[model samples]
Target: MLLAHDDEGSGPAVVLLHAGVADRRMWDAITPALAHTFRVIRPDLRGFGETPMPAEEYADADDVDALLASLGVTDAAVVGSSFGGRVAMELAMLHPARVSSLVLLCAAYRGLEPTESVRTFGAEEDRLLEAGDVGGAVDLNVRTFLGPEAGVAARELLTQMQRRAFDVQIAADQAVPGPAPRRVEVDPTAIAVPTLTVSGAHDLDHFRSVARHLAEQIPGAEHVELEWAGHLPAMERPDAVLALLLDVLRDDPTVHAP
Candidate 1:
C-alpha cells in the first residue's frame, strides 16, 4: 500500500515520522520549511490518520521501506518522533543500507516493558474504553503526553488528531487486535549511521530514559534536549527542530549544546 503519504519538494529525501499521539498532521508545522530544502515525505502509519490497518500482522519498518521504494528513494535521512522513532531505528537495524541517517525524537524501542506511569495511564485508558468513551481516552492522552505548558491551541490540535486515530483504530479491529507481533529486537550498537537523538526535558521519565539510553548505546549519536518542550517537541518548537534538521543535512560537526 502507498500508506497515504505526502511527498513534496526535491533533493535528498527526508521522511518525517509522527508520534503515536498524533498522525502525519503533526508535522504540518515543520513540513513547509523542510520541503524547501529536501523532499519531505510524511506518512500516516497503519490505522492512523489516512492509512488503513493491515489485514494481517504487519511491520511498520517494512511499511516505511516499501513507501520509499515506491517513490524510488533508495536512501534518505529518516526523522521519527515517539512511536515513529521505533520504526526508524528498526529500519536502520534491519536494512542499514536504506537509511542514510536517523533523527530519533523521544523514540522508544519495542519489547521494552512499559514504565509504571505508562502502565497506570494505560489502565486509565482501558477504563475509558470500558466506559465506551474514546474521546475521554483522547483527553487523558493529551493531558498526559503533551507538555504542561501546552496551550489551548496545542490541546485542541492533539484532541482532534488523537480522536481521529481512535476512530480509525477501532474501526479496523473488529475482533481484539492481537498482542504485538514478535519483533526483532534492536541493538543500538549495530546502527552505524550518523545519528541524532532529541529529547524534551519536560517529557516523562520513561521517554527521557529511552532518549538517554539510545544516545549512549548508539556510537557517536549526538543528543539534544529541548528544555521547555515535551514529548512532541516538533509541535512545541518547529523552528528549533527545523534548524536541527538543517544542521544535520549540512553535516555540521557542531553538536547541540547540552
Candidate 2:
C-alpha cells in the first residue's frame, strides 16, 4: 500500500513519523517551524491516518525504508514519536547508513511488559474502547497522555488527537487484518548514529524508564526530559521540541561536524 505523506520545505530531508492511533496530521503544528530549516516528510503509518494497510505482513522498519526509497531519500534525520519511534530505532539499527541522526519522543521500545500502573491504565482504556465507550476512552487518554499542568491550549489539541484516533480506529475496523507480529527486537548499541531520546515528565513511568534505558544502551545517545509534557511533547510543546531537535541536528557530530 502507498503511504500517504505531506512534504514541505527544501533542505536536507528530515522525516517525521507519528504515534500509533494518530496519522501524519499529528505533526501539523510542528512542521511549519521545521520547514523553515529543513525539508520534512511526514507520512501516515500503515493502518492509521489516510495510509492504506499493506497487502503484506511487514514490520514497521520495512514500511519506513520503502517510504524513504519511494521519496529517493538515501539518508535523512528521522524524528519519530511513540510507535514511530520504535520504527525509527529499528531503521537506525538495521540500516545505519540511511539515518544521519535519530530523535525519539515518548517512544515505545523496551517491550509490552510495562509496569503495573501502565498495564492497569492500558487495560482500562482497552476495555472502554472495546465496549464502545469511545468518549470515555478519550477522556482517560487525555489524562494519561498529557501532563496535569498542560495549558488549556494543549487540552484542545489533545481533544483533536482523540477524535483523530477514533476515526483511525474506525478505518482499521473496516479493513482486512490479520494478527500482528510480536514486537521486534532492537539492539540499541548497534545504533551507532547520533541519537536523542526525549521523554515527557508526565508520561507513563514505563516510558521514562525506557528513555533512560535507551540513553544508556544506545552509544552516545542524548536524553531530554521535558518538565511539563507527557506522552506527546511534540504536540504539547512543539516550539520547545523543535528547538531541541534543530539544535541536536546542528550540533551532532554525525550530522553537522561530519
Give me the candidate number with maximum TM-score: 1
Cα displacement (angstroms), candidate 1, residue 52, comes to 0.5
**Per-residue C-alpha lDDT of model 2 across residues 147-204, encoded as one tens digit per residue:** 6655787767667766666766565565677325335788888888888888887788
Instruction: For candidate 2, give the lDDT of residue 235.
Output: 72
Q: What C-alpha lDDT do the candidate models reach, one value each? A: 0.85, 0.79
Tens digits of per-residue lDDT, candidate 1, 1-258, equal: 678999999999999989988999998878998899899999998878989775577778888889999999999999999999998998897778889999999997754567998789889999997899998999899988888566677788989999998887776676465324337578998999988998898988788888888899999897888898789878877777788888888788664753
Off by over 4 Å in 2: 149-153, 170-182, 252-258
Question: Every model's Cα RMSD, please?
Answer: 1.9, 3.4
Q: Give TM-scores for every candidate, taking all chains together and pairing residue i with residue i.
A: 0.93, 0.88
TM-score of 2: 0.88
